[model samples]
Every structure is written in C-alpha cells, then in structure tokens.
Target: MKSAKSETLKGWALALPLLVVLLGFLLLPIVMITIVSFWQATEFSIIPAFSLENYEFLFGSSVTYKVFWATFRYALITWALTLLIGFTVAYYLAFHIRSSNVQTILFLVCTIPFLTSNIIRMISWIPFLGRNGIANQTLIGMGVINEPLEWLLYSDFSVILAFVHLYTLFMIVPIFNTMMRIDRSLIEAARDNGASGRQILTNVILPLSKPGIMIGTIFVLTLVMGDFITVRVMSGSQAANVGRLISNDISLLQYPSASATSVVLLVTVLLIIGTLMRFVNIRKEL
Candidate 1:
C-alpha cells in the first residue's frame, strides 16, 4: 500500500507542470470567457453584471442560426473529404509501401506544405482558381467551355478545397499511426483463411482504426468549426460562419456578445468531442 501511494504521488509530481499549464492557460481563459458571456455590454464598454441578454440576442437573431448552419456545413464537407483521402493515403502507406525509409520520405513530403504559413498556402489557390486563372484558362484553351467558371473561386467549393488542403494531414497522421500499430499476423491469418481484401478490411482494419478516426474527426471538426480566416479569404467575405461572427463582434468591441458566441461554439464542440469519446478511448489506443 505504501509503494502504491508513493507511485501515485510520483505520477502527480510528474503531471504537475502540465496541470499548471492547463489551469493557467486553458481553464482560466475558459472560466473568464464564461463569466464574460453573462455580462452586460453597453454602447461604450462591457458592464460587469450577470444577465442572459447576450444569449437572448443570439437566440433572437436569425443570422446567428444561419452562421452556425454554414459553419457546420463547411465542417461536415471538409471532414468527409479529408477522411476519405486520408484513409486511402494511410492505407497505401501502411500496407502497400514495403520500405520504412520510403514511407518516411513520402510522409515527410506530405508534411512539406505545413512548414510554410497556412495563410500563404490558402492564398496560393486564388490565382489557380480565379476567373482568368490557370484553371479556367486551361479549360478555355482546350475548348471545354467558352466562359470562365464563376463558381470555381469565391464560393463554397473554394472554401472546402482550402480546408481539405490544409487539414488532411491531421487525419492522415493519426490514421497512419493507428495502422502502423496493427498486427501484421492478424492480416496474414485472415488472408490464409481465404478472406478477401474487402472482408479483411471491413472485419479487422476498420474496427482497429476507430480510435484514430475519432481523433481525426475531433481535430477536423473543431478546426473547421472555429476557422474564419480561410473562409473569409477564400469566399471573399461572402460567406458567414460562427467564427466570423465572433471575429466581427470582437472587432466592434462587443466583448460580452463575442464571449457568449464563443461559449456557445465551445459547448457545441465539446458535445461533439464527448460523443466521439464514447466510441473510442484515445488514451488506451495511444
């Protein structure tokens, strides 16, 4: 009993730094924001008083619902595309690639874009997808269409494309990590039993990769939900999202309202992450 108690104390000592950081940076801010969310906002400044006026205004506005809906739409689309592409890429790297060196090289290549600024990478797509950009010009030169595609840029398509480009790596890394840990003997045994590729994948690999999928889902969903810069730049400020709403509020010095909106977004994201946690204990998998 004494040894176990000592070990527990050691574990707590080891975790002390992380606990302090989390409490100082994360939990404190969250608590402050939650408190501010209920405060009253005046024309000139925020008043420190308890009230649901901010939330009342939020629920009363149709624009709030529209912004949230648009945010969810973008998140769902981006998550689906990233999951599909990431899974395919991870599967190839884990199973098809024989050499560890080559796999590492390829994985590093995949991460090369991340070394630069996300803003720069997002803006780079503008010239390629613009009205007279390379994409439209190529199509026109090939007689594919007489006019440039108006929907190619400054639309939902461009926003989703930018998201997929930026966030696919998040999905790939986790899924690949999970795949690498899977036992090769299980796969060989399944094959020896005359199980087809589809059967083996469905019955074995998919089940084992759930933790990675859940992690990836949580990452992509939270990212897309909270992102406004990509949507702002890619959509030419034409699109609306919850993040944009909060940003605009902050810009106008509506701290209380912005805090309320942020609180709502945080709660929504937490609910989603909690649901995902029910399916996979990420700690155990890791």
Candidate 2:
C-alpha cells in the first residue's frame, strides 16, 4: 500500500509540469478566445455580449463556404498524395534497404528540409517557377513552349505540390516505423508457401500496417487543413482557403468573427481527428 501511494505521487509529480503548461498555454488561451468571441465592438472597446452572430455570419456567407470547401478539398488531396508517396518510400526503406546505416542516412536526408525555415522553403519555389526561372528557360530552350508559363508559379497545382513536398515526410516517418516492426519471417513464410511478393504485401503487410497508414493520413489531413503559408505563397490570387479567410478577417479587426471562425475550425479538426483516433492506436505510434 505504501509503495502504491509513493508511485502515484511520483507519477503526479512527473505530470505536473505538463499539466501546468497545458493550462497556461492551451486551456487559458482557449477560454480567453471563447470569451472574446462573445464580445461586441462598441464605440470604443469590445462589449461583453453573448450572441451567435459571428458564427451566423461565418456560416451564412457564401465566401466563407467557398473557402471552407476549398480548404477541405486541399486537405483531402494532400492526404491522398502523402499516403501514396510516403508508403512507397517507407516500404522501400524498410524492406529493401538491408543496411541500417544507409537507411539512417536516407532518413536524415529526408528530414533536412525540416531543418530550414518553412517560409524559406516555400519561397525557393518561386525562383524555380518565376518568369526568368530554370523551368521557363529549359522549356523555351528545349522548344517545349515558346514562352514562360505563368500558371506554373501561382496555381492550385503548385500549392498541392508544395503541400506534398513538405508533409510527405511526416507521413513517411510513422509508416516507416510501423514497417520496420514487421517480422521478416512473416514474409519468408509467405514466400515459402507459394505466395508472390505482391500477394504477400497485399494479404499480410497491408493489414498489419493499417495503423501507420491511418495515423499518417490523419496527420496530413489536419496539418493541411491548418496550413496558411503554403496556400498563400503557392496559390497566389488563384485560390482562397479558410486559413487565408481567417487572416483577412483578423487583418480587418473583426476579432469576434475571427475568433468564432477559429473556434469552428478547431472543433471541426478535433472531431475529425477524434473519429480517426477511435480506430487507431495513435499512442503506440507516438
């Protein structure tokens, strides 16, 4: 009984720092934002008046609806592309790369982009896609096109490509970790039992790796949904996303409306992640 009590105390002591941080940063900010969302802008200061007008405006506006749908559509596409590309890379690394040292080097290379500022990385694309860029010069030199393609620099395609480039590694890491845990003997046994590589992968490997795939998908979806920088930098004026819309509201000093929009976005993302978490052991991956 004494030992149990001591262990419980130790656990609580260890958790106290995390608990304090959560309350200070996340919980307090959320509480404040919730309160602020109810405030109304009077002649001078925002008055504390509880109303659903902000949300009503957000939902009622056709512009917000379009932006929300755009955000959702981008997230869906990003998640799909991340899964496909990440799975191939992770599968090859886990199964084909026999040398652990080489695998480690490859993984480090994959993470090098993350070491740099994300904004810098996004900006780098402009040089490659600009009017006097390599893409244009090469195209014109090779006679593929007589002129530079303006569409390449600022379009939905560029935005999606940037998203896939940035977040694919997030998906890859989780999938790779899961793939590495798969037993080598399982594959050998399947092979010895007259199963081909494709059959073994389809029947055995895929089912076992569902947790990783699910986790990667969720991560990509949530991150893409929340991302503003890539959309703004890559899409230019051709596209509008929810993050951009929220930024516009904040810039215009529509604090209550922005808060309401943020609250809705946070709730929607949480609900989606929560639903996915029910079917996955996300804790194990972490």
Q: Put down candidate 2 lDDT per residue, 90-139, tens digits, no spaces.
A: 99999999999999999888999999988888889888988899999999
lDDT, each prediction: 0.95, 0.87
List CA RMSD, all candidates.
1.2, 1.9
> Cα lDDT for residue 86, model 2?
96
Relative to the unseen true structure, what is the C-alpha lDDT of residue 254 in candidate 2, on a scale of 0 to 100? Answer: 78
Q: Write model 1 residue lDDT over 172-236, tens digit each, in one string.
A: 99999999999999999999999999999999999998888888998899999999899999999
Residue pair clashes in candidate 1 = none
Pick out the ten consecutive residues of candidate 1 with the lowest summed lDDT. Answer: 38-47
* Per-model TM values vs. the true structure: 0.97, 0.93
Cα error of candidate 1 at position 120, Å? 0.4
| Cα error, candidate 1, residue 10 (Å) | 2.7
Candidate 2 wrongly placed segments (more than 4 Å) = 42-44, 284-286
